[model samples]
Target: MLMVMDEPKPNHWVFFSVAQNSPDFTLTIVFFILPHSEVKMGLKQTIKSLDAFPRAEEHLLQKTQTGALVSVIGLVIMATLFFHELRYYLATYTVHQMSVDLKRGETLPIHINMTFPSLPCDVLSVDAIDMSGKHEVDLDTNIWKLRLNSNGHIIGTEYLSDLVEKEHADHKHDHDKEKDHPHIHGFDQAAEALVKKVKQAIAEGEGCRVYGVLDVQRVAGNFHISVHGLNIFVAQLIFDGSKHVNVSHMIHDLSFGPKYPGIHNPLDGTVRILHDTSGTFKYYIKIVPTEYRYISKDVLPTNQFSVTEYFSPMTNSERAWPAVYFLYDLSPITVTIKEERRSFLHFITRLCAVLGGTFAVTGMLDRWMFRFLEALTKPKRRKETECGSLSGDGCCFGGN
Candidate 1:
């Protein structure tokens, strides 16, 4: 050591230290890489095992005729049960819900296609009233009043609104000053024309076919067609000789919206006045809004209503106005029914589950049954062989 020892360079010292610890470095590398290599190998082995088909002994694969028949029957039963489960899964469905509409003043159309056998088209007038004190009387627009004969044959068809419009158009220039004044103008002329038409029809003694659509506010309202004239007060006060009008009706088609299959309207039928007394027939209708959604994504908004009827007969002093009244109220809640089918992916997953589960269960049952049968027969065969050997020994001893 006393001999001159030169100082070591930084790079040389670092290289020498690393070389001295080469064994630790090699161990650390092996520690990290070994586990990763083992994991990769294990993953490959697991995949290989999963991909490989199951293997069985030659004796296990062999089957007797009875076993084969039983296996076939079991498979048939399993298939039936699987299909039943599939059908049940498809049939069991859920409905999606939505919020109800609570807004007011929405209008709904009431379609009427009625035939009056005794009420003349002239005197039969349509009127509607709601809880809000709004009244619509003698509706003519969008209404067709067809005159019928005594035998219920169509005599003439008239659109009341059209006649009024035509008369107004004809006298448009002649009554410019009258049109400016609201006292006696277009509406008065229309009313005069309507009265004339009604008088003509009454003179002919014609039956009525009332068919039209009436748009009413979404509230409790009653619309009635009565024999009492538009000027009811004048008729009662001056013309006290007015006779009682019969109200025998045949409702052809009545609904809230366009006709669809399986839709039922309570009033679409033959309604006759059994008693000869003058009265009012009232239908209290409760309407429920419905939305029908098809699998093809077609959505139809419609309404369903239920009705209870009441008839009020006229008293001796009361005026007789034979009419049919529809009083309707709408519900706040709406029902949305959607049609759907099982998806392809869902069906495939269920099919696989059913097939795999059935096969596994049946296979286990079959194996257990085969083992039990073998165990039961083995003792019996062994006893029979023992008895036969004993008999052979007895014969040998006797011969000796």
Candidate 2:
């Protein structure tokens, strides 16, 4: 009527609908969570089953002497095979990767130790040039020149740069004296020093040893030592063109960086230049950058290079300077070697497979052998018993 029976309230209707769907919501939740729990339980059961030992009848499990011996031999063989496979796996597990080196114009230090048996220390010069047109002549910095006798024994050693600097200083002092003639107090000390140096060099022996580190651009370039001292007045006066300079050289240590044990440089210990004629020996080298990662987590960055050599003898028409030239080029690709060990889980799985497979196969083979032997002897036994019976004797079939 007028009251409209306090029309069913909105709250009541909402409550009624929720109550009606509550059972369905509970069932849906159970349906979602139940399978997950069941799956987890099933997984646990499977793992347990795999870990459990197999069961068999007592007689089947029993071992005879022959069977036991075969099993032991089979186990030994399986162990040997497993170890071999493991070693192979470990050896083959190498990871290879590459990376870009964006650092350009970097300098690479080339350490060189060389001996020239016939070249005098005073007459030798070091020169370097790159593809970029950068040239370095008489590179004395970080270099050493050792004076050696005809017997290839070191007699004296001096820093190449220091020697050059002293000479330059003497020349400068002489020029300064000329500028200040009034200050001149001695009988040309600079000239006297120069003469002394010349005499000392002349008196020195022929063999020369060069040991130094040259820093060059990472790009292709070459550094060489040559006997250009024929142009020097003092050097010319000392030799008087009497003896041909022997260019035979031994490379003691040539590498891209600090020396490491067991690393071999192809050019190291290389001896060439058996002839005395003026010529050029050129080496074309291709360098590959490598990164080695050991299992101990040590990382080493090194370079390996291959070389191709060429020799050109000087003719009367083109009497060029005798020199050794190294031409090198960098490879864009980098090589990485990493040592890895097998995972414990993987090793265990393989071990299980090997043992189980061997056991099954060997057992089958042993059973077949035993059965064959029994079959072969049974016919002979039967024949023997029949013969005894034919002879009218009381035949005994071994208490059968």
Candidate 3:
């Protein structure tokens, strides 16, 4: 059998077949119709007149002068609001939040740079003690001392280890490890040499600058620069009297943690001067941990602090020492500052609201003004028609 099919039409098909063995004995025709009417009707019916936003035909729209003016003003208002929102969306802002501090068993890094104008390097020692009974005595490993002349110029630089080794090499035979090294406070023959060196430097009007990092446990602690680490006899011999030992100093930089942008450390460039009397200088500080989050999702850990200072005059007691002390305590709260920008969706919604509200308000105002003008003219039109019907064009209704 040979079968032939005609070109398909919408929703219908036609097929014809001939009997090849009988040389065209019979011819058959068949029709197939596809059920697509409902689908087409459904698609066409999806576009309905129940629209949230509707528009009038161009021929039906009547443009009035008042309506045009209202539209122009509304456009201006929308443009102004849109520009304002755009600026707000493009600008970056910082959000600050506070929470309880949860950090534990961490060490705090302190960077200190100070200069003593009237104190010699041999008589100045750095020591730290905390409320936890942890004493960091004679902190010298990471510290550097710069010898300055009377004119505040650097003369020489010395490391703590090198200075100690030099002193020990000169007085090796006189070294007594047991009695001399008692708690790092008892000075032996080597200490006597250090005192002599200090006396000579004092005669030449010398000064000292100390700068280094001190890593201590995170707790309330006090670190100071004084002659407290020296033996009583050695300290007494360095100067004429303990009362004359001046503790005047200048702080270059003092911070609790690594520096980041916008971090202000109050202790930088601080100067303290003492007169003829010796005194103790103390700084009571409160440290708050801070974390800064950048827009790129990078985080920086740092610290900020506030300080209160006090000074106490020293008496003639041998136990009294002149020093510059920094006492600090950590706050239990942490602050987080994050950089953020407005979301795109939020900006879009705000823009749409501004446009829609202005348009609707202006349209209502135009309609009300048009109706008021129409009401005012309606009575005049009625009087003119009545006069024209009663008396012809020559009739005068009023003085005119």
Candidate 4:
């Protein structure tokens, strides 16, 4: 059997088929092609059918005053919530975690800025001693001294080496002056005159300001400023007595490590004034190691601390020096702070919740208010009867 279809038109297809063994078997196929515009329209319609939110025609839709008010209120609330969420999304937060400090052979850097209005730069020395018996005497590296006058003004600045060289130059000048004028003064008389001159200069109100960094082992230690570099006899001769040495000082800044965000050093801008008596001012500090991790994954190593202070006055019988001592120890616990931001998915979730909840609540309120207004405006029906005996059926009439 064979079947044949008509000739194909433009944008159309026709096919014919025949079976070899059966005379009654036949097949026919036809395809009509659509224009490109119609194809695109069909595809768009298919996609639109999948939309869950259906829109009603404007002519068929009815609007209510209550609904309009509710929409305005909802819009305001939605905008508020959106801005709030935006702020929360853009903001970064800090998370703190604690762990055991396991680092080995690390050094702690200490920055100090101190002003001693009562101590002169000539006799001031900085010394450090650790629990391991490592002693640093007359620390000179990376240290600076500023000579200040009575008005708290910087008159000169020098390091330990500069001061030593200056002193040697002065001694050579004195020796040459003695050689030139042989009968003027002996070496002993010149030495006495130099001491008297030093005392007079000190009485004219010269102060010292020390500021620098010191690196030490990560262990318990004590650092102090005193007249330890000079012999006891010379120090006593200069100051008249150890009891009269005024250790009054102001600590401008003190920190154990490089500062990061939110690092608070407890001893900054601390002023200790000792009046009329010489004493030792001791600050006992406990240091906590800290690590700050930025959002960019940069890590900053730092430290934070708290301190306690004690003052021990010198007794007449006690043979000791007046100084300012900073005693510090380390904590085994390490604190880590990290900066983080809210995730995008979290922001999306909050936005959805805000929109959906506001829509549902406002919709319910609008509906209830509309129904209430409708009930109030609706006319009530009344029944009335005018009866007269006329026939077997009763006469009744009523209209509302």
Candidate 5:
């Protein structure tokens, strides 16, 4: 099928039809293929049916070309959609990480004074336990009771009753946790006996430290410790064989880890240093909780594992969360996160392809049919006529 526009051949109009007239019924187009200098009398003008005109077959080819171009554009759009989907499937989720500030380092208010009953009385060991709420039917609501290690040398039940009263006397309070242990007597006296022993041992040149560092180690790893009362600290003084041992210099070399006390790792319980210190030796220590989560090694070691301490946010928390941030990336929920960025682009590309392809195919068909219908119904130029009139060029068919 084809559509054609031709330059009118001069002096050739095949002017036999009445449709070609001098006035009225103006056509949409005009063709003047022949020389205009021929001085013709009012050349082709009005439009009429092909039933009144005819033309050479060579002119139909132009319309077919138009249809093909439209088809190609549509095909390109559709193909782009398929390619976009392929790229998306191969896309990988990327995790962008930055050093974040984590809130850590909460100094526990509790402190213990150690005392031992037997050895030289110099090694004072103090232990306390409070476990009156356990063994109830509802473990969630039930308070896990603190208890004494009756099977061993330590007497936990007696210590709790005695220590609480004396410690709280500064605030004029009682051990409300020990309401069940009403039989305990002279809580203040017991506390006094222990404190007096600790003072005596300190005067006699003995070791005085916070007890239960082991309990903490069993749950959280060794972290940094910040001593609030630096002025009243009892740290080991290194001897330079001089008049004074400057312990303050040694404290300067130590660091404290996160405040949260890391997670419970039976084998992971230990402390270490992450930074370089000025001193050759570090006085490492751990402070246990008043209550034990589980039985731990009887004594804690000064050195156990490699612990990195920092004053910043990622502290010696129960579990170092930063180490596991990658877990969030590959999780199932992350698919939605990934899709949020990726899926919409794919849908648009695919839709464009579909629409574009359909458009091209439609354009191709429309152009071809339009040309065929045009050829069958539209009027054609008559090769023979008055040879010079204003109305014989294919009824001046509208824009070929």
Candidate 6:
């Protein structure tokens, strides 16, 4: 359905159209009190009525329909949830393709020296604020995330879009994990929500921090994270070298690597950061860090340190959830960077398991409900009543 309202002074007309089976499929009324611009509340409502949030719902969802309408709404909801998962899954696919380099069984040990271009890597003083997080894991390994790369710095104009994309006003990172390993078999839609929460955490700077050489360096910002279904902030610090800070310790000790072989072939991907005068740097995001050592031809060691080691994608995860907060294993502590590809792949496999399982479970539920709806369309057979002859003695005896 579409509506057009004309306002002569502005020489403009408002156009509003509602989808056939959407919740906001009927006439909508809105009120606005704006003194500055000519764009009134009516115009705002019209625009909002047209912009369906897809998987999300408005405060007042259409609820009049009883049978058929409900079915349609359910179907739409299913589609939106699936799409949300697909978008994140695709995003992970892109990240995974750009970072890892190894076959299923290939091995690369740590403790090797490597050399790369001596280009000047840009540096920045970071101030990380964890909107949500939990330190339920072991004290030593509390902030571990399961990804192929480390927490990276943004460099160059290439990553400006991504940097902007990940930014949000409030970072909420309390993603709950069930006891299910790798992936849960059901609740695919919920999984999508979880992925979103994780992304928000990472983008909003859950654990990102920096410390200058000063007296105040003893304090780390509060990281807001939920623990075992409780909302709380994980306190950490970024200290001067003389005194150790909690967040600084985690950042310095954390390790990242390849989840699989062949994620980036030819050579270990190199991430280059060019800092211009504008206090911003440029980055080619899909490249690996300049830290791996290629001993002879076939053997390689990956334990070396490079600046860009923080932003490679060696595994397939829907978003950067692991990098943001503390991940839970049976034990709940974050693990350090692995020296071999097997360890990395194991972690990546677990992450993919979660993502794929989420998609599959939701898809199945959607299909099942659709099938139920189709069954409802079948015509019901009615039974006919047969009248036997009345009692013989009565006048209504069977006709001869």
- In order, the Cα lDDT scores of the candidates are 0.64, 0.65, 0.78, 0.77, 0.30, 0.29
Score candidate 3 by TM-score against the native: 0.58
Q: Candidates ranked by lDDT, best first?
A: 3, 4, 2, 1, 5, 6
Give the per-residue lDDT of model 1 (tens digit) for 1-400.
Answer: 1334356433332112222345455421111122455666877999888875778888787686657766787789778977876786576343545558665656777888998876666666666566665434433347789989877799888774432211212211122333465364334565667656655555565688989887776776666676533444323322232335457687887787664445678778856644455666778888878777766678877777788988777555543445687788877878676767778688777777877887787777777878888899999998777767887566534643
Q: What is the C-alpha RMSD of each candidate to the true structure, in Å?
A: 11.9, 12.4, 11.0, 10.2, 25.1, 32.8
Candidate 1 Cα outliers beyond 4 Å, as residue runs: 1-99, 135-141, 162-205, 233-243, 259-261, 343-400
State the lDDT of candidate 3 residue by residue for 256-357, as single tens digits: 888876788998999988888888899999999999998889998888999999999877653456778899999999999998999999889988888889
Q: After TM-score superposition, what is the CA distance of residue 54 in candidate 5 from its true location, in Å?
A: 30
Candidate 4, position 198, lDDT: 53
Best by TM-score: 4
Kindly report which residue stretches of model 4 are placed more than 4 angstroms away from their true locations once superposed. Answer: 1-84, 135-140, 161-202, 353-400
lDDT tens digits, residue span 28-101, model 5: 44433434433352433323242364664886646555466655655676567667666664554432222322
**Candidate 6, residue 215: lDDT:** 11
Q: Of 1 and 5, which scores higher on TM-score? A: 1
How many clashes in each structure?
0, 0, 0, 0, 44, 24
Candidate whose lDDT is highest = 3
**Candidate 6 residue lDDT tens string, 78-101:** 566566645544432211112343
In model 5, which regions exceed 4 Å deviation? 1-65, 92-400
Residue-wise lDDT of candidate 4 within 53-122, one digit each (tens)?
A: 9999999987987899999999999999999999999988999999999988888888989999987887
Tell me the lDDT of candidate 1.
0.64
